[model samples]
Target: MKINFSSKTKILLYFSVALILGFSIINTVSFFYIKSYIDKNLSKDVEIFKRIYMYEDQSKLIPYLKIVDSNQNINQNDIVGKVDGKYIVVDKGKVYTELIHFIISISLWEIFILFIILIIANHLVQITIDKEKELKGILEVFILALTHKIKNFLGIQRVNIEILKINFNEKALMRLEKAYMLMEKDFEILIQALKSLREFRDKREEIDLKTVLEEIIKELESIYPEKSIFIKLSSFKVKADRTDVKNIFFVILENAFKYSEKRIFITDSMEKNIYTIKVLNDISFQEKGSGVGLEIAKFLANKYNWEIFNQSSDDEYIVYIKIPKK
Candidate 1:
């Protein structure tokens, strides 16, 4: 069997174990030390009582002694005598023994309560750290995605400009305009993505899955017209932030286009409030590209409680996304 614990749980477990061990050690040492101290005092008192009984002071000791049942058996360390029609008994260490037990019980209770409070404090601290880490990761991914998108647009603009310089035709001008439009659209998407990242709560609304997939496909077709693409999608509704859904689709589709051999296939279906999208493409295993986009996609999927699965063969790659409907 395997057991997994979160950071908070693990920390609490470790601290609790240490605390219990520490308290146990302290209690054990204190108990023995107290017992030894009481025993020493008890022996001395017994000696003093014996001297008084043997010599000059049974009457003086009567006031300090306690009356016990005559039938009670006295230990060798206890002192007993008859004084004014009552049997007086002086215990060697019974009082101190009870005091020790009472102190230990109270100490154990205090330690148990303190352990609970410390565990709660540790859990709260762990929660704060996790939230900060999540925010930092999202910010880092946003910056990297923005940089990658800008660089790609710049490269496209540079190519179109070079073509214009060489040919200076209406065709070149049209291509430049198209490139500018794409850059503008990408800039808008980037803004939306950043906004989505900043939101701390889900802003879910009904979204048409078919429309989102079509938009992604159209965008990719514009960028790589030569790449053959096929889509088999059913009309379905999902509840999620529009920008988040669009970004997830865009990231995966963009990667598919970037690495696919010559064709991309997309299929989707909806059943029992769950929508599954599968993307399959032919690509060699040796041609694996940088996985930054997929990483970002996976992160976003986790945030939205969606599932993503990837499988690759010698010459084919496939990705599946399972998202719940609102």
Candidate 2:
């Protein structure tokens, strides 16, 4: 069987491995430094004591001398003064063991503290990276679905237009014109969909939400000459990147056009530091297709962490979006 990991899982795994490896390397290096420092200092102490006893005053050597007897036992606090040139060398293990234990314990704790700090930093970076990857994945999928739906709808329009072209009588010509108009309207909707998809897929900067909606409304007027689109704006903004927001608006407007039998009512609200845009139209349940529009809108909404609510009654269809103000 084949296994696939989500981007978040991959990031966590990579972070864990890096965190562990980094701490391990640091601990190893710290141990090595301690070992070298201990070895060098021990040798230096032995050399200094040897020189003092052999050439300097042995009477003063008592204070600096830590003697080890032949049984390999050392007395760290013992005072043994010698005359002019005597040596203080014993072979004992007890004093040496105690000194080694003290140094190792202190060095081990230092290494532990450093490793802990590095691990914490790694975890924080991992969390940020995982969040970004998760958002990227969702956006990619949503855009892909949008593209698929646009193409499918466009293809249907093309077939309908071609059928209309083959009929050329006076009465047929009138019906052909209506079919051509529908095909043209579908193309306009595709353009709106593409506009939204491009913004997200290309990672555009922040856009004026009001301006984008106005543009969508302007285009809708031309597309549906038989239907009216009304807008009521109240100074609200979406805390979404430009491209994502454009796609979101495009999807909403497209739904309005698809469902509205006569008129579409659109309005915005900004209250309690939150922005809400509502688009309402009348629709028939029989008008539902493969549900591509709703699906694409939902997919992209999740990508941006936006809340989407849909409500429909026998006489009306409504879409409400709540956008947080950053």
Candidate 3:
């Protein structure tokens, strides 16, 4: 038979068992100590009873000084007499031991406290498990989408490149070359996205920030030879994975050109322990249908614990990335 239980019920069952076991052990130890204390007091009471019954050297019953163990509930008349010129009174231990009363009285309160602690521990464990499951699902979906796109783009690029290699005529060859070039550009973008995912797999190191920016700009300029981007260098360092650094710039550069109809200005600065890279273009934000470039850039920046800012004034749109100085 398949056994099934709701999540709440399962948590309660486990918590109750743990709470019971812990409280049971504590009560057992407390009971043992209380029992030992009571036994010690009872032995002392026997000696006190002997002294009360003795009647000088004659050792005969005086009737007035009758010995009575404190454990026995004597009449008021029996306890109204003195023993050997001293008034007799019962010791407090004979009526009830403090340790025994304390153990029994606090058992309920201790059990209540234990129940509260167990409930909190169980809930915390459940919350952590749920959040971990959610993050895993998101990462799995991202990896699947990236893999599918990369495979399809590479297949097309491979076919075109092979065709271009076979052609000898200049006219046909030139057209094939252009087609292969465009396919290759798209493939590079896909590859950059893949590298961004790779950083999530425990691969991060100090990368040369300036060198990565230079390479991305070179690749972007290859597509539009007439288009130009000015670079401003800053003496700063970043502790980020090489793949991640390259992808960050690649996404931003792609976004700048896609939205702007003119030249893009790229500048870098280091102030107050922050390494900021700004991509400025003469364009304002507009409603575009399903674009992932800016979204991915922001995602990568936030994932690396870097700050991203986007602002527009007049006709200039600025994208700023602030990485912590390493």
- Each model's lDDT comes to 0.76, 0.64, 0.65
Q: Look at candidate 1 and give me any clashing residue pairs.
A: none
Per-residue C-alpha lDDT of model 2 across residues 81-130, encoded as one tens digit per residue:
32334435433243356456765686677568656755775577677786
Rank ordering of all candidates by TM-score, starting from the highest: 2, 1, 3
Off by over 4 Å in 2: 1-166, 169-207, 284-286
* Per-model TM-score versus the true fold: 0.55, 0.65, 0.54
Clashes by residue pair, model 3 = none
Pairing residues by index, what is the TM-score of model 1? Answer: 0.55
Q: Which model scores highest in lDDT?
A: 1
lDDT of candidate 3 over 31-76, digit per residue (tens): 8777777657555654555554544532232222344455666666
* Model 3 root-mean-square deviation: 8.7
lDDT of 3 at 174: 54
Report lDDT (Cα) of residue 155, candidate 1: 73
Residue-pair clashes per prediction, in order, are 0, 7, 0
lDDT of 1: 0.76
Error of 3 at 71 (Å): 11
lDDT (10s digit) by residue, model 1, range 108-206: 796888778786879787877778888898889878876876776677678778988897878667766766766676577678877766777678898
